[model samples]
Target chain A: MLPILIYGTTLGFTLALIAIGLSLVFGVARIINFAHGAFFAIASYTLYLFFITLNIPLPVSMILALISTATISVVMYIISLSRVRGMELNEMIITLAFTIIVIELLRIYFGPSPLGVPSFMKGGITIAGYVVDMQRIFIVVISIATLAALAFLVKKTRIGIGMRALAQDEDAAMLIGVNREKMCIISLAISAILAGIAGVSVTPIMTASLEGAWYALLNGIAIVILGGLGSLVGSLIAAFIIGYAEIIIATYVSSHLKSIVALIFIIVILILRPSGIMGRHHEIEERV
Target chain B: MKSRKESNKNIRTIRKERLDRGARARSKDLYVLMSYEDIAYVILPRVLPPLILLAFPFIVRDTYWHMVFFLAGYYAVASMSWDLLGGFTGLVSFGHSLFIGFGGYFTAILNVWYGVPIWLSIPIGTLAGAAMGTLIFAPCLRTKGVYFSLVSLVAPLVMVGSILAFAEITGGEEGIYGLENPLTELQWYYIMAGLVLLTFLILRKIAYSNFGLVLQAIRDNEPSVKVSGINPVRYKVTALFISGLFASLVGSLQAHKLSFVGPSYFYLSISVGIITMSVLGGVATIIGPAIGAYILTILTEWLRWLGGLRMLLYGVILLILLNFKPEGIYRYLERTYQTFERQVVEE
Candidate 1:
C-alpha cells in the first residue's frame, strides 16, 4: 500500500505536468495542438543528446532543452499554424502534421533505439519493508515544485492573467487590447516547454524513445478529455485518477491493461459527462 | 438633351434584358435537352469517371500498378465512409480505423477459428464492425461539439490496447498471419473497384435522400433540429452506423487482399489518412473522397523513393493542402465541370 501510494504520486505528478500543457493550449488557443506530445519526444531526445551524449550537467541540460523546445514551438506557430488560427479542423490536422514531422525528423536524426538519462539520485529508501528508489522521490519533488511554480506564475503574473483572459474569451480579450496572436505564441511556447520538462523528467524512468510521442500523445489526450479540455485543475485531478488507477490495475490485474485503463477512463468520462468533472459547459458548443 | 439621355438609358436596359434572356435560355438548355452540348456537359462528368474506373482493371496489367489501384480503391471506399459522417453529418471522426480494424480482425478471427469461407466472413465482419463502432460511440452521440471527435480520436487506440492485452486470443503483436489471400491481384482490383462504385452510389443516394437532409440539418444546427421534433441522437447514431458499415466493408476486403490482419490496421494514421483523402478530394461530395484517395495513394507511391521522409512529406502536403485548398479538388472539379460563366451586363 505504501509503495503504491509513493509510486502512484510519482506517476500522477509527471502525468499532470505532461497534460497541463495540452489543457492549457486547448484552453487559451482553442486548438488541440496534437503536436503537444512531439514536444515531449523533442525534450526527451534533447535530454538524451545533452545529459547522456554530451555529458552536460542535468540541470543545465534540462534548461537548454526547455528553451530549445519553446523556441521550436514559436517557429512552428509562425511558419505553419498562424494562418489557421481559429479554424478548428485545420488546426487539428496541421498540428497532427507537425507531430508527424517533428517525431519522424527526430527519429531520422536519433535513430529508433531507446536512450536513458541517468537518474538525478542514485540510491533507495526502505519503508514498511518496501524499497522506494530515491529517483522516484526526486521526481515527485521536482513535479510538485514545477507544478507549484506554474500555478504561481499563472495566478500572479501579468502574462498569466492575459492567458486566463484569452482562455475565457478570445474575442473579448482581444477587444480589451490583448494581442491574440501573441497570446497564442506565448501559450504554445509555454505548453511545449512544460511538455518538454515532463519528457525530460520521465526519460530516466520511462527511457526516452521516439515512441514517447505516441504514448505521450495518447496519455495527454486521455488526460485532457477526462479532466475536460481546458481545465488545468481538472486535468491535474484526472492525471492522479488515471495514474493511480493504472497502478492499481497493474498491481492487482495486469500491467498489460495500463493503457487500456486510460482509454476506458476517457470513454467513460466522455459518455457520462462530456463537460468533464469541473469544466465549463458553455465552451463545449464551438469545439466541433 | 433630356430626351437623348432617356433614349440612351432605354437602349442600355433593352440590351441588358436581351443578355439576361440569353443566359436564362442557356441554363434551361440542360433541363429541356435542346442541344448536344448541354447534354454532353451534364452527362460527361458523371458518366466518364465511372466508365474510366470500370475500365482501369483491364488497363493496369502490371502487378505493381495493380497493387496501387487496389490501395486507391481501398482509400476511396474508406474515404466515402468518412465523408458520410464527417462531410455530410459534421461528426468528424478520427478513430474511423476502429471500424476497419474491427472488420479485419473479426473476419480474420472467424476464418481462423470457424473455418468460415472468405465470402461469408466478409459480410459478417462488416456487420460486426458497424456494431462495435456504434456501441463504442453510442454513449457519446448526444454530447455536443467536438466531444464525439475527441472520443473517436482515441477509440481505435483503445481497441489497439485491448487487442494487445488479449494477445493470446488476438495472436499478440504480429497479429493473425498466414490467412489466405483469396483473390488474385487483378481480381482484388476489380472487386475493390466494384465495391468503391457500389459504396459511392449508395452513399450518394442516401445523401440526396430525405434522411440525408435531416443529417445535414443536424450538422448545421442540432438544437434547431431537435426543436423541429427530430431526434438528433437517433440520426447521429444511424449515420455513424452507416459510416462504420462502409468502412468495415473496405477493411474486411483489405484483410482478404493482404491475407492478414494486424494491430497496425488500427493505427491512428489510417484514420487521419482517410480524413486527408476526403478533405483533399472534397468534403460533402460522396465521390470526391474516392478521387482524393486515389490521388493521394498514387502520390504516396510516387514518393516511395523518399524512404523515411515519406511521412514528413505527407505531413507537409496535408498542411499545404489544408491551408490553400480547404475546399478540396472535388469542389474545383465540380465547379468547372458543372458551371458555365459568361458576361452579364447589370443595368
Candidate 2:
C-alpha cells in the first residue's frame, strides 16, 4: 500500500509535467497538437542520441534535446498548423500526420526496441520499507520545480500574459496589440520544452522508445480532457487523478488493463460532462 | 504587314468559348440534349470508371495485381464509409477502425467458436457490427464537433485494451485465425468489384437526396437544422449506421479473405490511412474516396521496398497534399471533365 502511494505520487507528478504542456498549447492555440507526442518522444531520442550515442555530457545533451524539441514544435506550427489555424479539423489532421512522420522516423533510426538510459544518480532511499530509486525521486522533484516555474511564467511574465490574452479572445487580444503569431509560436515552444523536460527526466526510469510518444500523448490527452480543455488548475488536478488511477490499476488489477483507464475516462467524461471536472466551457455542453 | 494585321483581326474576332457539349441550355436550371452525344456525355463519366473497374480482371492477367486490387477494394469501401459520416455529415471520426474491428471479430468468433457457416457469418457480422457501432457511437453524438472527434479517436484504444485484457476470447495479439475461405480468388475479386460499385452508387444516391442535404446542413449548422424542424441526431445516427454497414461489410470480407482476424484490424494507422484516402480522393464524393483508397493502397504497396520509411513518406505526401491541394483530386478532375473549348466569332 505504501509502495502504491509512493509510486502513485511519483507517476502523478510526471503526468502533471507532461499534461500541463498539452493543456498550455491547446489553451493558447486551440490547435490540438497531436504532434505533442512526437515532441515527448523526440526529446528522449535526441537525448539518447547525444548523451549516450555521441558521448556528449549529460547536461549539454539534455539542453540540446530540449532545444531540438522546441525547434520541431515551432517548425511544425509554421509549416502546417499556421495555415489551418482556425480550422480545428485540419489542425488535428496535420498534427496527427506529423506525429506519424516523427514516430516512424524514430522507429527507423532507433529500432523498435526500447533503449535504456542510465539514471543521473546511482542510489536508492527506503521510505516506509519501500525501495525508491534516486531517478524516480529526481522525477518527482524536477516535475514540481518545472511546474512551479511554469505557473510563475504564466501568471507573472509578459509573454505569459500575452499567451493568456490570446487564449481568452484571439481577435480581442490582437485588437489590443498582442502579437498572435509570436505568442502562438512562443507558447508552442514552451509547451514542447515542458514535454521535453518530462521526457528527459522520466525516460531513465521508463526507458525511451517509439511507443513512448503515443503513451505520453494518450496520457496527456486523458488528463487534458478530465481537467477541462484549457484550465491549468483543472489539468493539474486531473493529472494527479489519472496518475494515481493508473498506478493503482497497475498495482492491483492486471497491468494490461492500466491504459484503458484513461480511454474509459475520456469516453465516460465526454458522455456525462463534455466540459469535464473543472472545465468552464459550458458552451460545449449546450452545443451537445 | 498586311497579312499580320489580318491574323490579328482574326484572332480578336474568333474568341474561344468553353461550353457543355451536345446540350442546349434553356435557362440556368434547364437543359435540352441536342443529340445522342449529350446523353453519352451525361452518362459516360458516371459509367466509365465502374466499367473499367469491372473489366480490370480480364485486362490485368497478373495474380499479384489482382491481390492488390482486392486490398484496394477493402480500403476503398472503408474510406467511402468514412466519407459518408465524415464528409457528408461533417462528423470526422478518427477511429473508424472500431466498426471494422467489431465486424471482423464478430465474424471470427461466430465462425471459429460457434460453428457458424461463412455465408451466414458474414452478413450477421456486418449487421451486428453496424448495430454495435450505432449503439456505442450514439452517446458520443451529443459531443460537439471537436469533442466528438476526440472521443472517436480514443474509443478504439479502449477496444484494443479490452481485447488484450480478455485475451482468452480475443486471442490477444495473435488474434483468431483459420476462419473459412471457401471462395476462389476470382470470385472474391468479382464480389469486391461489385461491392465497390454498389456502395458507390448507393452512397452517391443518398448524398444527392433530400436526406443527405439535411445531413450536410446539420454539419454546417446544427441549430439551424434543428430550427428547420429536423432532428439532426436521427439523421446523424442513420448516417452512422449506414456508414458502419459498409465498413463492416468490407471488414468481414477482408477477415474471410485472410482467414484471420486480429487486433491489427483496430489499429490507429488503419483509421489514419482511411482518413488520408478520403481527404486525398475527395471528401463528400463517394467516387473520389474510392479512387483515393486505390491510389494510396497501391502507392503503399509500391513503396514497400522502403520498409519503415514507407509510412514516413506516406505522411509527408499527405501533409503536402493537405497543404497544397486541400480541395482534393476529384474536384480538379470534375472541373476538367465538365467543359470543352470551342472558337466563337464575335459579330
Candidate 3:
C-alpha cells in the first residue's frame, strides 16, 4: 500500500505535467493542438540527439532541447495553426497531421527502438524498506516545484492576467488591449516547454521512443477530457485520479490493463457528464 | 450604357460563367432536349466515370496493379461511409477504424472459432459490427461537436488494449490468421468496384432525398431541426447505422480478401487517412470522398519507395490543402467542368 501511494503520486505528478500543457492550450486558444504530443516527443528526442549523440553537457543539452521545442511550437503556431484559428475541425486535423509528421520523422531518424537515457542522479533510496529510484523522487520534487511556479506565474504575472482575460472572453480581452495572437504564441511556447520538461524528466523511466508521442497524446487527451477541456484544476485532479487508478490496477491486476484505465475514464466521464466535474460549459449538452 | 458586346470589346477583362447556367435556363420547366450537346453534357459525366471504373480491372490486367486498385476501392467505400455521417450529419468521428476493426474481428472469430461459412458470416458480421458501432456511439450522440469526436478517438485505443488483454481469444499480437481468401484477384476487384458504385449512387440518392436534407439540417442547426418537429437523434442514429453498415461491409470484405484480422485494424492512421480523403475530395459530397480516396490511395502506393517519408508527405499535403483549398478538389473540378469564362467590360 505504501508502494502504491509513493508510485501513484510520482506517476500522477508526471501525468499532470504532460496533461497541463494540453489543457492550457485548449483553454486559451480554443484549439485542440493535437501536435502537443509531438512536443513531448520532440523534447526527449532532441535531448537524446544533443546529449547522447553530440556529447553536449547534460544540463546544457536539456536547456537546448527545451529551447528548440519552444521555437518549434511557436513556428508551428505561426505556420499551421494561425491560418485555421477558429475552425475547430481544421485545427484538430492540421495538428493531428503535424503530430504524425513529427513522430514519423523521429522514427526515421532515431529508428523504431526505444533509446535509454541515464538518470540525473544514479542509485535508489530505500523508503519503508522498499527501494525507489532517486530519479522518480527527483521527478516528484521537480514536478511539484514546477506546478507551484506555474501557478504563481499564471495567478500573479501580467502575462497570466492577460491570458486569463483572453481565455474568459476573447473579444472583451481584445477590446481591453490584450494581443490575441501574441498570447496564443506565448501560450503555445509555454505549453510545449511544460511538455518538454515532463518528457525530459520521465525519459529515464519510460525510455524515449516513437510510441511516446501516442502515449503522451492519448494520456493527455484522456486527462483533459475527464478534467474538463479547459479547466486546469480539473486536469490536475483528474490526472491524479487516473495516475493512482492506473498504478493500483497495475499493482493488483494484470499490468497489461494499465492503459485501459485512462480510456475507460474518458468514455465514462464524457457519457455521464459532458460538462465534466468542474466545468461550467453545459453548452455541450444536447438541447431538447 | 454601352452595348454588351461593345462593352466586352471595350475592356479586356475576363468573366467566368457556368456553362450549365445556359443549359439550366434552356431546360427549365420542360421535357425537351435542346440538342445532342445538352444530352452529352448531362449523360457523359454521370455515365463515363462508372463505365471507366467498371472496365478498370480489364484495362489494367496486371495482378499487382489490380491489388492496388482494389485497396483504393476499399478506402473509397469507407470514405463514402464516413461522408454520410460526418459530412452530412456533422458528427466528425476521429476513430472510424473502430467499425472497421469490429467488422473484421467479428468475421474472423465467426469463421475461425464458430466454423461459420464465409458467405454466411460476412453479412452477419457486417450487421453485428454496425450494431456494435451504433450502440457504442448512441450515448455520446447527445453531446455536440468535439465531444463526440473525443469519445470516438479514445474508443479504438480502448479496443486495442482489450484485445491484448483477451489474448487467448484475439490471438494477441500475431492476430487471427489462416482464414481463406476464396475469391480471385479479378473477382475481388470487381466486387470492390461494384461496392464503390453502389455506395456512391445510393449515398448520393440519400443525400439529396428528404431524409438526407433533414440530416443536413441537423448538421447545420439542430435546434432549428428540433423546432421543425424532427428528432435529430433518431435521424443521426439512422445515419450512423447506415454509415457503419458500409464501413463494416468494406472491413469484412477486406478481412476476407486478406484472410487476416488483427489489432492493427484499429490504428489511428486509418481513421486519419479517411478523414484526409474526405476533406480532400470535398466534405459532404457523396462522390467527392470516393475520388479523394482513389487519388490518395494511388498516391500512397506510388510513393512506396519513399517509405518513411510517405507519412511526412501526407502531413505536408494536408497542411497545404487545408490552408489553401479547404473546400477540396472535387468542388474545384466540378466548377471548372461546369463553368465557362469570357472577358467582359465593366458596366
Candidate 4:
C-alpha cells in the first residue's frame, strides 16, 4: 500500500508536469496541440543523444534538451500556426500530422528499441514503511518547485499578465496594447519547456521510445478532459485521480486492461460532462 | 484614285467578314469542348473503367502480381465506400475497419462453424456490418464533428479489447484461419476483380446522381441542408449503410482469399491506412480514393523490403502531404489538368 502511494505520487508529479503545459497551451491558444507529446518525445531523444551518446553530464544535457525543444516548438508554431489561424479543424489536422511526422522521424533515427537516461539519484530512500527510489523523490520535489515557479511568474510578471489577458480576451488584450504575437510565442516556448522538463525527468523511470509519445498523449488527453481543458488546478487534481486509478487498477486487475479502462472513463466523462469537472461552458473563441 | 479608294473599301469589308467568321468558329469550338468534357467525365468513366476492370483478370496471368492486383482492387472498392460516408458526408470515422473486421469474422464463423456456403454467408456479414455502423455510430450523428470522431476512435479500441477478452471464440491474438476451399489464385483474382468493378460502377452511378449532390450539401452545412427541406440524417445513414456494405464485401473477400482472419486485420492501423488513401486521393472525388489506394498499396508492398523504414516513410509522407497539399494529389492533378487545358486553348 505504501509502495502504491509512492508510485501514485511519482506518477502524479510526471503527469502534472505534462498536463500543465497542455493546460497553458489550451487556455491561451485554444488549440488542442496534439503535437505536444511529440515535443516531449523529441526532448527525451535529445537528452538521450547528449548524455548517453556524447558522454555529457546529465544536468547539462537536460538543460540543452529543454532549450532545444523550446526552439523546435517555436519554429513549428511559426510554420503550422500561421496557416491554421482561427480554424480549429485545420489546427487539429496540422498538429496531428506534426505528431505523426515527429514520431516517425524518431523511429527512423533511434529504431523501435526503448532507451533510458541514468537516474540522477543513485540510491533508494525509506519513508515510513515504504522504500522509494531517490529519483522519484527528486522528481516530486522538482515538479513542485517548477509548478510554484510557474505560478509565481504568471502572477507577478508583466508577461504573465499579458498571457492572462490574452487567455481571458484576445481582442481586449490587444486593445490594452499587449503584444499578442510575442506573448503567443512566449506561451508556446514555456509550454515546450515544461514538456521538455517532464520528458527528461521521467526518462530514467520510464524509458523513452516511440510508444512513449502515444502513452504521454493518451494520459495528457485523459487528464485534460477530466480536469477541464484550461484549468491548471483542475489538471493537477485530474492527474492525481488518473495516476492513482491506473496504479490501483494495474495492481488489482490485468495491466493490459488499464488503457481500455482509462478510455472508458474518458468516454463516460465526456458524454456526461463535456465541460469537465471544473470547466465552465464558455465559447472558447480561438484564432487557432 | 477613284479605283484605289474602291479597292481599299473592299479590303476593309473582307477583313470585317473574316473577323466575324473567326468569332463564330470560336463559339462553336467552345460548345464542342464543353460537350466533350461532359462525355469524358460523366459518361465515359461511367461506362469504360468498369468494363475494363471486369475483363482485366481475364487478360492477366495467374501470378503473384495478379494476387496483389486483386488485393488492391478489394481495397479500392472498400476505400471508395469509405469516401462516400467520410469524404462526402464530412463525417470522418476512424473505426471503419470495425465493420470490415466484423464482416470478415461473421462470414468466417458462419462458414467454419455452421458449414454454411461462402456465397450465403457474405450478404449476412454485410448486413451485420451495416447494422453495427448504425447501432454504434448513428447515435453519434447528434453530436458535432470532432465528438463523432472521438467516439468512433474509442469504439474500435473497445472492440479490440472485447475481441481479446473473448479469446475462445475469436481465437484471440493467434487469429482464425483455414476457411477457404481449394481454388486457384487466378480464379480468386477474377472473382475479386468482378466484384470490385461492380461495386465501383454502382458507387460511380450514385456519385453522379442528385443523391450525391444532396450528401455534399449536407456535408457543407447540416443546419442549412435541414432548412432546405432535406433530412440530413437519412442521407448520412444511407451513405453509411452503402459504405458498410462495400466494407463487408471486401472483408468477406479478404477472409476467403487469405483463408484466415485476425484482429490485426481490423486494427486502428488499417483504419488509418484507409483514411490515408482517401485523403491522398482527394476526398469526395469518385476516382480519387481508388487511385490513392492503388498507389499506397503498391508503395506499401515495395516498402516491405525496407523493414521499419517503410512505416517511418509512410508517416513522414502523410505529414508532408497534410501540411503541403491537404486537398491531396487528385486535387493537385485536377488543377494541373485545368491549367493545361487553358494553355492549350489560349495558344
What overall lDDT, based on C-alpha atoms, would model 1 receive against the true structure?
Answer: 0.84
Candidate 2 lDDT, tens digit per residue, A191-218?
A: 8999999999988988998878878888
Candidate 2 vs 4: which has more lDDT: 2
- Candidate 4 deviant stretches above 4 angstroms: A153-156, A170-184, A282-288, B1-45, B105-117, B126-142, B150-166, B181-184, B194-245, B266-268, B302-304, B332-347
Interface C-alpha root-mean-square deviation, candidates in order: 2.0, 2.1, 2.7, 3.8
DockQ of 3: 0.53
How well is each residue in A144-249 modelled by candidate 3, as lDDT tens digits?
9989988998899999998888878888999999999998898899999999999888888888888788778888888988888878998999989999999999
User: Where is model 3 more than 4 Å wrong at Cα?
Assistant: A281-288, B1-33, B342-347
Q: Any runs in candidate 1 off by more than 4 Å, and if so which?
A: A280-288, B1-26, B30-39, B178-181, B338-347
- For each candidate, the alpha-carbon lDDT, in order, equals 0.84, 0.86, 0.86, 0.76
Task: Give the number of the best model, judged by lDDT.
Answer: 2
Q: What is the TM-score of each candidate against the true structure?
A: 0.91, 0.94, 0.94, 0.82
lDDT of 4 by residue, A1-288 (tens): 887788888888888888888888877776677778887898899999998999899789999999999998888888767566665555655675677778777887887799977798898987895778889988899999999999998999999999998888888999999987788788888988888888988999888887777667767777776777788888888889888888887788756565565566666666676666777755321221
**Best-first order by DockQ:** 2, 1, 3, 4
RMSD of each: 5.4, 3.0, 3.6, 7.0
Question: In candidate 2 chain A, where is summed lDDT lowest over 10 consecutive residues?
Answer: A279-288
Displacement of residue B14 (Cα, Å) in model 2 is 8.0
1 or 2, greater by lDDT: 2
Give the CA lDDT, 0 to 100, for residue A19 in model 2.
85
Candidate that beats the other on lDDT, 3 or 4, i.e. the better one: 3
* TM-score of candidate 3 on Cα atoms, chains taken together: 0.94
Candidate 1 DockQ score? 0.54
